[model samples]
Target: MPGIEAGGIAVVLVARSAIAAAPRAEMERLAGQVSGLHEIALATYAFTEQGQPALREVVANLRRRPFREIRLVPLLFPMEASFRAWIGRTLARWQLEWDTEGPAIRIGPGPNASERLTDLVSDLVETAGREKPFMPAEHPATTGSVVAAAHRRVLVCQGGPCNEAGAAAIWGHLRNEQEGQSLRTAGSGMMSATTSCLGPCSLAPVVQVWPEGTVYGGVNEAGIDAIIREHLLGDRPVESLAYPANGRKQALRLRE
Candidate 1:
């Protein structure tokens, strides 16, 4: 992004998706500040399946446009130690996936923008001694004894085995699917949580549904859709994909 040309440049504000993240409007405000860019977008590394677009998806779409270059502004700070390197490798992956001709891809904001962010951080740190008091009414942690009206509870295994077997991707897909099906709403009667393990470690990427306690094995994007649409929303477990191992057949029998 040299010579300071105005048009033909696309800027993307990229971050890793997280649960209950800060407002998208805040990021939009930042993107709007810069002028003369061909296009500006927001993308994430697919931590959650919310309103954010995947980095790969956004890059691909921007490449279709006649922009001279695509710039990815990393919005995530305090990321994992390997995050910067990971971003490089991810861009490499995108290049390999789409081998056709496209604009040059570069990561990070220009120096002036980076300096502004640095100054903002410095100002915040200069006043870091003042602590904001927590408000319990705004963010209550504990609930009363009243029983939940939810009809089903889903537990996605995050055990060591499952994590190695793609539990993170599964969780992301599940989040998107849950949102698509409107299952996360308070009145949806559907609840979901992450669990350490669900037994049947043989079925490493397991998803368990409550009431009947049916454990699903080898879940993927399609499996998540089936679990939400056919199982939770349809009131029936996807039996074919269900792995009733480790004595859980008894719990599944309750449904019969």
Candidate 2:
């Protein structure tokens, strides 16, 4: 007997705009721009009990349906303590469950304002204000009398766990995206490189960029693109995507 499918694909996008008051509209807009099977934003429920169940139900429903793919994109800022411990734990559980169920669990890349996202933010910065402010004498990316221009170098972690989790593929995409292009010209990228051992084993598949020491975990090709286009190219930082030095949760600064 031929069977009818109930849903296309289930994607549970858990966001933390409420707790951190970080930018959510921009993320929703970007997700709309990217092509995907399905998307659901858990803005309000994200902090509540209902949210977890909603997430589980999505995964369960997806598992029941004969689909080859299921994706979960955490839209929270990376450094938020709750997101780090609480949310990460929840997602980890779901991931394990998915593994047992045996479906291709493709976790969407983000934490927003990622390296690729910087590209878009730089453009926005250029358009802001009547007159362009003089670039900082010591921009984070520059050094010496020239004053560091803060070129936004992307440092992807190619460590053991990260590579196994597909960091190499994302690194390739990040490199390919920035090849032959100048951050000054495209207004993005002073430099981009893939590195070894960013240290946070729990947060494998990481990429960090300069000026603010912004770090992005759970990243992939599209995530890298978002960082390049939004945060690197545009003036705004992807406040949501960063993993801070301290484990404590604090308000995210848009710029260093």
Candidate 3:
């Protein structure tokens, strides 16, 4: 099927020529399994060094294509200095160009294994299931459960960056929102708590989900409200509340 016409959204991957090539190919394969992708482009540079050349190339190409909006997924992981620095400078440049020129570019996160990689696994299952349909029940657990059947936890990062970024406000908001209002998932209500830095300092004020081990970055006041109401109460991820980090995608597995 033809890719989704996301109005003006273009999916641009910032990766070195070699590194991004494989992941981009994988993303394409994986994306084929899913629907609603913005138009895609791979930036030709390494994240270890300045990406000015590649950034210019990408921006030029994008200008020619004229996407009304842009979503950048850095092909790196862990929100290191490289990804952190790039996000600030590059986004500002793009924003300025859009205002002065045309076609604004919006941004989002990398392809974390959880949200953007199911397509790869699904495709594999499809290709290999010709002889016998793959079934989860038939395959016994290789290891014990990563999460307790009924465990409740809320890990809030109180490290310097997170605190300075206003995690305190978020903490209070979640508390007020969750109080009196009981939430139960699997079996027990979520036990709210806090912790040290999650290390996505550039994004600041990161929140990690336990048992599931999902991390959300770039959170603030309104974000706290939606997260509490949706994820905490409904036991689902609030996609709109999450911002892109170092890479387009990496999965922090609950278990090894």
TM-score for each model: 0.58, 0.38, 0.35
Which model is ahead, 2 or 3, in terms of TM-score? 2
Question: Which one is best on TM-score?
Answer: 1
RMSD of each: 7.8, 18.6, 18.5
Per-residue lDDT over 14-70 for candidate 2, one digit per residue giving the tens place of the 0 to 100 score: 543231224445544555544333332211222212112234445655576554455
Candidates sorted on TM-score, descending: 1, 2, 3
Q: Write the per-residue lDDT of candidate 3 for residues 69-115, one digit (tens) a residue.
A: 65555665444443444455544644554565644554445445347
Q: Model 1, range 18-86, lDDT digits (tens) per residue?
A: 445465666656667754343443222323223455555677787786777877776666544344454
- Model 1 lDDT at residue 149: 75
Clashing pairs in 1: none
* lDDT of every predicted structure (CA atoms): 0.65, 0.55, 0.54
Give residue 256's error in model 1 in angstroms.
30
Q: What CA RMSD would candidate 3 show?
A: 18.5
Cand. 3 Cα-lDDT: 0.54
Could you tell me which 10 consecutive residues in candidate 1 have the lowest summed lDDT? 41-50
Q: Which ten residues in a row are the worst by lDDT in model 2?
A: 42-51
Q: List ranges where model 2 is wrong by over 4 Å.
A: 1-150, 180-184, 248-256
